[model samples]
Target chain A: MKTKRIRAGAAAMTGVLLLGACGEGGPGGSGGDFTDGKLVLAVMNDQSGVYKDASGPNSVKAVKMAVADYKKKHGDKAVVDDIEVTSTDHQNKPDIANTKAQELYERGGADVILDVPTSSAALAVANQAKTHKKLFLDVSAATMELTGAQCNKYTFQWAYNTYMLANGTGTTVTGNGDKNWHIIYPDYQFGQDMTKSFTEAISKAGGTVQGTIPTPFPNDNFATFLTKAGSTNPDVIGTMQAGGDLINVVKQFNESGLKERGIDLAVGLMLITDIHSLGVDQFAGTMFTDAWYWNMDDESRAWADRFRDETGTRPTFEHAGNYSAALQYLEAVQEAGTDDADKVVAKLEGKKVNDVFLRNGEIRAKDHSVVHDAYLARVKKPSDVKEDWDYEEIVTTIPAAKAFPPAEASACSM
Target chain B: MNAVLQYAVQGLAAGSFYALAALGLAIIFGVLGVVNFAHGAFYMLGAVTAAVLLDTLDLTLWWSLLVVPVLMFAFGVVVERLLVQWLLRLDPLYNFLLTFGLTLVLVELVKQKYGVSGLPYKPPKLLSGRVDLAGVVLPRYQLFVFLFSVAICVLVWLVMTRTRVGMIVRASTEKPDLARALGINVGRWVTPVFGFGVALAGLAGVLAAPFRAITADMGNNFAIILFAVVVIGGLGSIVGAVVAGFMVGLVEAFGQAYAPTYAQILIFVLMALIILVRPAGLFGRKEATA
Candidate 1:
């Protein structure tokens, strides 16, 4: 009888502890139950599709590393001890991303979701994050809609956007006297945004878009499209495609005598790994906007070496962005002493953070657009490439303000 | 006139690959009475094998062209013996479904081994440049692909028509009971015939490696088009499959060149029209009941 009574008492205590943990939005709270301080970060991106190499499982590794780095730096003074990181592959689909985003926030209790690549999928998550009042840090997807029309308080886009690419590459190329542009874009939100932004950027810089071709996503045969574009023979052929499609487009474009006809090839947005995969010879003399290059400096190289050991590949800008975003979120939670959405958002807005990955990183308060220094890199010729990954030569550094459009231009009501 | 000629030539080149792949599909369907959904995956395997051979083994494109098909043939034989032969006596749907599962398994296996990123592959130096006919220039690789595909088709035709082994295999597939009653061991030829058909798909993949983005799911992209080609040409008609392959290719190319946005519907529309006009396909034999 005495032992039974003791067990009953223990059971009651366990019940009370469960209540404390469930105090997140429950009635029994002192304003709010900040008792259970657990940080769960979920990486949401393409893990087994075209965008996988750029972000995917590597992004998960990057997040874990950032968490480790955060703990090492703060030690006992760290934000939270109970931290967990998880991931889901969206497969570049908007519906799947929405479902995963909901599960991550509602059931899994993720504090932040990182690295959604496809714009349509990212937008879906962005809307879900806003509705759920959760944090989403998009490290890769390029649609400016994230910070423009669809932007929300809980979502922050960390890397380059379509506007940044348009301003960086489109305007630069136009200013260099490539007056006529033929833009071939994948028929998706991201690609369409790239086309729109690039067209506006070029026209504003005194260039005319001769034509815009909306090609199928994941299109392998760009031969006919190339021939048609070749017939027109515009001064510049702007490829607004990404991943495997981009590789094919660039290859066919080069082989179609457009270059011999003196038409320049301008990639609206390109990852470093793409140039590496295609080799310096194929994309030589091509120009594009780059978010981050792994071999940019000693700091970058050191981080990249660690990343290489982890992933067996050099970290692309998207992968690096995941690390930086995770670290920033942790820092914000530490500064605010809470992982509450409002508190974290307040802590992140307009704060200048510096790390190996981002310099002068400012998460814009209005549209939650993280702005940092961007660069324009031109593909190095085969003779100039000293190493395998030595594909791009940094042409010019773009200031944060100049790279991104003004915040007022954003249609986001946030 | 220049645009028309350009689109035509380019379309024909793209069609050649579809033709090669569809020919393999037709042969398998004809002999096995099974729709091999793994056809595209086999094509992808061919391309990836070439990539791995070049990147890891330091082998060249020529070596891949020479060796990969033979390796693929061996793989097909094993797959046929272990998996496909078991499903032969069952419903045809069983093999169809089995091939579909096998395709998924193969695709996932490739994804696990080599992540879903595109790999780089350079063409042979001999086929690297453009050929100028008048003022317009076309890629030399495309021209080579066209010529090589035509040559392969002719060789396949000659084998089926002239050679003893090919004649026996063709006769066995077409009139299995008759050939079996004539004291021929028709069962022995089944495995080799399947392997030969799979090998043809592998060959097309090797040819496509230099042009398409060398990736695991690259096959899925081409597979849908190849299926349309097989359907339009008739399910098991060799002539129909080859002709339909080129026809679909030309249709897609012209569609993209002219319509651009609506090209997705062009091939399907053509398929619908073809089905309406010729129920057994342009080359498919009419049913005795009909």
Candidate 2:
């Protein structure tokens, strides 16, 4: 009887300890630790699918790195309670991503949604952000419509956009020398926006768009398109294709022996990930525009070095953009002294956000589009590469004023 | 004139890939009486295997071409024994449903494993550059794909007609009960026949890697088109499949060239017109009951 009583007492103690552990591990644990209260910043980015290889995982890592840096800088008195990062596989579907964003906001308490690659999905999430009164920092979606006709007060385009890319690279190249263009674009919103922006910029800069071919998305074979491009025989082939589509087209163009045909490729927008996969050897001497490059300057290089050390891969434009957006948002929140959406947005507007990724960048009051310098880069030859990840040469830095389309050109009423 | 010739050549080159993929679908359906929806998945796997082999084992295109098919053949055998065997006793619809589900599982698994940026595969050095054909500059890789696909189709035809195993399988497909009663052991032949079908898919995939992106979801679109090809061609007819594959390729090529916007629509329209004209397809056997 005595031994049975002792066993029951031990069981009771075990149950108490288990209950205590569960309580402490719950969502509302350690409430008094943060004087300003913890602000949960949920990051929802594409963690799988086509864009996964380019921006998904890296975007998440970048936000985490930025949060870590913020905490280190603020020392012991950092108002940030804890940053909780969660992601979803949008699979380039707007409906799915929008739904996931809503769930993240309502239940997950996501302060900001970052690096939505697909424009359609970005627009959907932006609408949700407006409804929920949350900050939506768009890091990757390139469609000008996000800041144009569909511009929301809640959404801020932090990185590059179609207008900026076209104006910076297409117009600059066409204006300088190569006037006539044979363009091949994907038949989609992003592609349409890119082609329109490029054509308009080229025309405005006294250049001619001789021909344009609109191909379907995820088109595997571009032999026919390349042939058609070659037949046009313009001074330059302006490719607005991105990701795998871009690589396939460029490779096929090279293999078509058209490089010797005097039809140089003027890439409107090329990501470092695409170049890395395709190899710089084949893409040598090609001029393109990018929002960020790892080897841009000392500060950029240092940040890239640290990022590479942590992530084991070079920081992509979208990845760097995520960092920029997160850091800027955190700064805005700090300045506002509250998590209220309007107050934070007010603090963010026209605020000069100085970071390793971007310098002297300010969120535009009219459209919430972050204005920053874009780099015109040429692919470095194999011999020029002193090490891996050193694949680009910054040809010129296009100023913010000349990089993006004029506000008057935008269809946004605000 | 030069521009027209270039477009034609380009069309034929792309048509070759569609033909190759369609031919594989045709062979699997013709021999097994199973609408292998996972044929395109096998094609995708073939390309991915080649890319992975090239990356991991430092294998060249030649080695990958040889090795990938064998691996896929083994995968086919396993699939047949484990999943397809049960459906063989059931209706053809069951096989289709099973294969469709299998495709989803395989594609999702690949996505989970690889995370879909699409691994790049380089063409062999010999077939890397372009060659001028009658004043039309053509990608050498495309030319090779066309030639390779034709060779494979011819080879498959030769095997189906000449070999004893092919004769038995073809005979069984035509008269399953008779072949079974004659002690041909249709059960024994099922696994190898399935393996051969899978091998054809793998071959198409090996040929495709150099031209297309090797993504997990790459097969989904191609599979739907392959189904259309099978319907347009006579079901279970190798000759019909070959002819229809090239025919569809030409149609798609010309359609895209002439009307870029309606190219995809034109394919379905052609399929609809063909179905309306000949319910059994271009070479399909008309049902006596119908």
Candidate 3:
């Protein structure tokens, strides 16, 4: 009888767990009514895998900081109350990320979802946001598809896209006498998109593509690819790997002493988070572009100082984007005077948002793309830096018009 | 010729890690007949322990290489005595399930504690740069890992073959009933042997810390691959495990180099082909018919 009781207890516990896992929002979960009349935000990103090093917990912290700042500025009538934030580990898988977003929105009472780091995963969540009629402010996930062919009315792409990074870096480097390009890219959609954009941009700037090599995603051994790249003997070798794969590739490339062989390393999209993982010594002399840098301007520096004080690390591009998106989203809701998704989205569609990171950045109604300055940065030398977290030196700032892809090219019906 | 030599060196460097991990898996299976799903977790623990020690005590890689495995060995002993000992009398499948569950628990605990953001571990200053090896430059750290792994494997072989303790271990696996009849406390040795196998895994983790990103789920992929290595090597054969580990590493490295897209698929294909030819593994002994 005692054994039977124990078996029954185990079965009951399993039932409870399964129900909890499968249930829609219980009280106080995401997408529930904000009883306290405060906007709750859900910051979802790959808390693990390739994007984690740069975009995970720090991004959540950035959004929180933005909420705190917004609350301070609009103290009386614009009080942001009961603001809660939660995160999920997407592990770079689209299916897992999509499920997590659904859970966040359906059960967590999130008014706005921010900082999804993968492109495919971002697209999944964007689709879900439209179905749910919720606001999705994409802080990362650079595929133009989120604001282009796969664009949804409820979604906004706030940070750098593949087109911006590709055009900014590729055109500049190839035009400046580094005309012959060799490419080593990950064999995925993101990699293919980057390579395609880069090649077109380079050729458009009167450069030639010597060769291209696509490696498997999450590939560890890069010696073979590096050796093959060395043989091609291009003016510059454009790397399209991200996260730990990027670190491994750069480290191995350095180890092979290939830099001495006259092949320059050019990164397609190197974030502040990647630089932090790699350190200054590993990335010195490497050039890349980003939407925001912690030390770029007084506003960014001041905001980063506040963020670092709270989070104990420098804010990454995804983190900065989260702050930008959250601030804009809350402002739109305030302007719309209601939390109705369509009303708030309409308010945000053609509005110009000024935040600590972006100056006079406008939300394009054409595809919900945020138009802002894109920074062309080079990794600062060890001797050039005076303190920790001081890495990039901003080379040039591309204007909003030149930085964004043309609406015709974007192919975003929304 | 230079490119081939370069790829070969790269393959050997990577193979060293696979070989060390496979050796641990083989040892556990040979003596205890447990698949040891937590071996990779133990490996991750080894790296994490080293990182924590570096933070707390400012320990260098030299000291971590010494201290981390010892601590993990004690942890292994505790786990075996408390958890694994209960499942010994049951079917091997029960042990597999128990250990697999333990792996999930350990990984989750680590993720909770470390927060899933990969912690970076820099190589010691001495091992930071590359060395010119026959005109091909190789990282000094990779070279060290290769040599260190081989030395440990040799040391393990020596202890297993040249000592009386080794004889007893072999006898226990071969005929546990007879070994117990001969007045050997076979039950007592099980825990320590398991602990030792776990320590070997921990050592592999310590060696891998600088080379790879130290994350909570680092062990999951590696552990699965380690099983494939053991299977290809002929499960429960130490020498076979080491050989097959290097073989898989080489195949994977070269396959990724030449084919690019089909690199991971090639590994599974190789394992399938090997199993077709040798169902019991390359070094596995045929079972005696009743």
Instruction: Please tell me which predicted candidate would have the highest DockQ against the true structure.
Output: 1
Model 3 misplaced regions, further than 4 Å = A1-40, A47-53, A79-92, A99-111, A175-178, B52-58, B125-137, B288-290
Clashing pairs in 3: A29-A107, A29-A108, A29-A109, A30-A107, A30-A108, A30-A109, A31-A109, A31-A110
Writing each residue's lDDT as its tens digit, candidate 1 over B89-127 gives 898899999999998998889988877766778778888
TM-score of 1: 0.94
Deviation (Å) of B125 in candidate 1: 1.4
TM-score leaderboard ranking? 1, 2, 3
Candidate with top lDDT is 1
**Model 2 lDDT per residue over A216-282, tens place:** 6776666666666667678888888888788778777777777787878888778887777666777
lDDT by residue (tens digit), candidate 3, A268-287: 98877667655677789888
Please report, in order, the local distance difference test score of every candidate based on alpha carbons. 0.84, 0.78, 0.80
Which whole-number lDDT from 0 to 100 does residue A119 have in model 3?
A: 83
Q: What is the TM-score of each candidate against the true structure?
A: 0.94, 0.91, 0.88
Tell me how candidate 1 scores on lDDT. 0.84
Reference contacts recovered by each candidate, as fractions? 0.69, 0.52, 0.34
TM-score of chain B of each: 0.96, 0.95, 0.96
**Model 2 residue B271 distance off true place after TM-score fit, in angstroms:** 1.6
What's the DockQ for every one of the candidates? Answer: 0.72, 0.46, 0.30
The DockQ value obtained for model 1 is 0.72
| Residue B21 lDDT (model 1) | 82
